[model samples]
Target: MKRFFAKKVITALLFTLILFTFSFLNWKVAYPDLKVSALSYWTDNEQNKWEQLSTLIANVSNTMSDKVFEKYTYIETYGYIQELLGKNEINNFEVIKATDGTLHYTYFTSGANDVSKLVERMKRLNQAASEVGSKVIYVMTPDKYITGVTKFERGMPYNYANETADNFLEELADEEIDTIDFRDLMKEDDQYKPESFYKTDHHWKIETAFWAFTKFVDVLEEKYGFEFPNEELYANLDNYNQITYKDSYIGSMGRKEGKLYSKVEDFTFIYPKFDTNFYFYAQSGSQEIKTEGRFEKSVTFTSLLSGDGDVYDATNDKYFTYMDGNPAFAEVNNFNEPNGAKVLFIKDSLMVPVASFFSLGCSKVYMIDPRYYYGNIEKVISDYKFDYIFVSYTPQNLTEEFFPFYESNLPGRWWMHDCPFINWNGVL
Candidate 1:
């Protein structure tokens, strides 16, 4: 027994020696992605411990590397937040002095991207609509930053392209383009400051969305010569600031910041009582025509006719957000429209709630986005004979934001190719 124990101890010591030799001689091979991947393990960058250890293993060493290393660190040596770490990221804003002589500055500053391309797309859509005897109206989506509710990183730039909201509106007026200026609608209500956007995310309050709902009703009455029952769908525009999640969400912007997620209270969408139900479609060949039963009460998987399940393997769970697996070519039918008007909208996800408000306006509504289209839109509008057409986006992302997402998915995927809207839009 003593001899066995002695042999085990001897073997363990020998293995440790071999590992230490490897760690000293060839560390880079063992950990090829050391900087980006191993950052979490290092507590201090200013210290020489990592350098001393790694230099023995690696023949190559960085001179004056501590400057670059310090930039990678978020917090400083004294445990204070370091402003120097993030040079290219964060927002710029004015700071005021408190009575206590303390500096007061907003953590998040408003910002946006491009607007020129969005305007060009709108011009094209309106021209196409006029050719088909259907007029085009646009919806101006407001971003979280524009709304003043998104928490911008501390040191990022807050500039948009030269074309701002005022300039874009002026250009639109100069060109005689018709649009639903939701920004004006938001500013009028004043119930929500621009700060009502999600602090850590890119969505707005449902309460503010109610104002959008009621505005749509008015737009319809004035333009299409029809009255909608607005009182039924929206009772009040109640604001809420209740916290949903208080943590670091690690949003897509690549910033390391803590976020406090909140939601609205007494939220409701006023939809007039339905005398008759309508069928909804998904991308899948199988259809769910209104009469079908057996959906979970809280969950809605509305249409099954135009699009496929996000995950072919998963049931009742899908990856698409905002519009519920919407396709460029899907149709909306109401059977309730007295004039039997057909409407078509070319837009992004901001049109989700806006489209829902349009439930009573048209017997059939078709959706299209040039970014998602596989073919032509003009030919599709001619064939459908739409009474109204709309193309819109928030000023920020209205430009070429989706170009990369669109390009990567082409050849294309089943959702974009066989999907009817993409091919039909270009042909129309």
Candidate 2:
């Protein structure tokens, strides 16, 4: 019996060794040609060669797993079961079905560490703005769930995002920071309907953004004495040509849930009816492109119905149709408002539409996403001599570790390339 057991053990060990050898060989052949950059520490020295081998093995394993799940029927079945059981969550997003027959993507809340980091960043931002003699208005846009439009019960384990945002705003208030909590206005507005936000996406509908922009304009005028051209242009939705694509969109959230679980949503594109000329200079990576024409021609359109392509591509992301899909840095010189106040807007994806609308009030809008912008932001502010500085971000963006002011933490990254730490004391 001992002899038989020893033989079995030897066989098992040989089998394991053979399997590992095959895996190593497969990794060598299928390894991705990753760019050797400062961001990756593996490309440092010959001694660190093991790092590449390990990473290649991990990548191959993940690729194989993905292929398995893609073809396996049981994996999809399990995902469906998880969705029905309310256990489906991917990348902090879970599809919640509202009583109104609409699906919404809800995200997890910010932890204590995230909130604390956000508060610290905001304090630093306040000091930076003071030093630069720029008035800062921090705007926090609410998620769909924050307005109480969903049918789900409050205080669910997944519903703490609103609470996190509230806590952050409360802390900001305690610090006497100037802020615009749009969630309050959204909740108070009687005109807001279920359609105010996208049924299948995490972003608010264009109508909702327009409504919020109007209220924001009021705040700007009342608080900062800034004047916007032709409030009537925006006040009346009819003034803009509205084109609706029925049953057209499957948002970032819905795509994750798949068509089997999440229903399709509609998309509406609104453009100004009045004659306007906008010259946009957009820079991403090392490429810079300049375009000048009417709003429809000048702005990059990602919508399938935008007369760009023949068939509607399911992968066509319409969210990026605004401001050409959020370039790392962009400058819009509005000929319509030449000599108007120059404004510096730092924001996340939430401000895509808002930045376009801002052109009506400002001569030039310098927009940058700190996540992608690598240049020294302090230099941009000083060069433009911006009359107003607006910082807009959603609660989820606020909780991100790489929030605008904390870009220094991410070394050799997109936000830190060519970026310099501002001497707040020297500016003051």
The TM-scores, one per candidate, come to 0.53, 0.73
Residues 146-194, model 2: lDDT tens digits: 4455565454335466667788888888878888888777768853466
C-alpha RMSD values across all candidates: 14.6, 7.5
Q: Quick one: best TM-score, which candidate?
A: 2
lDDT of 1 by residue, 195-262 (tens): 44433234454445545766776766787664453335322333212222222122222122211111
**Which sections of candidate 1 miss by over 4 Å?**
1-121, 147-154, 161-163, 223-276, 284-326, 338-340, 401-428
Q: Which prediction has the highest lDDT against the true structure?
A: 2
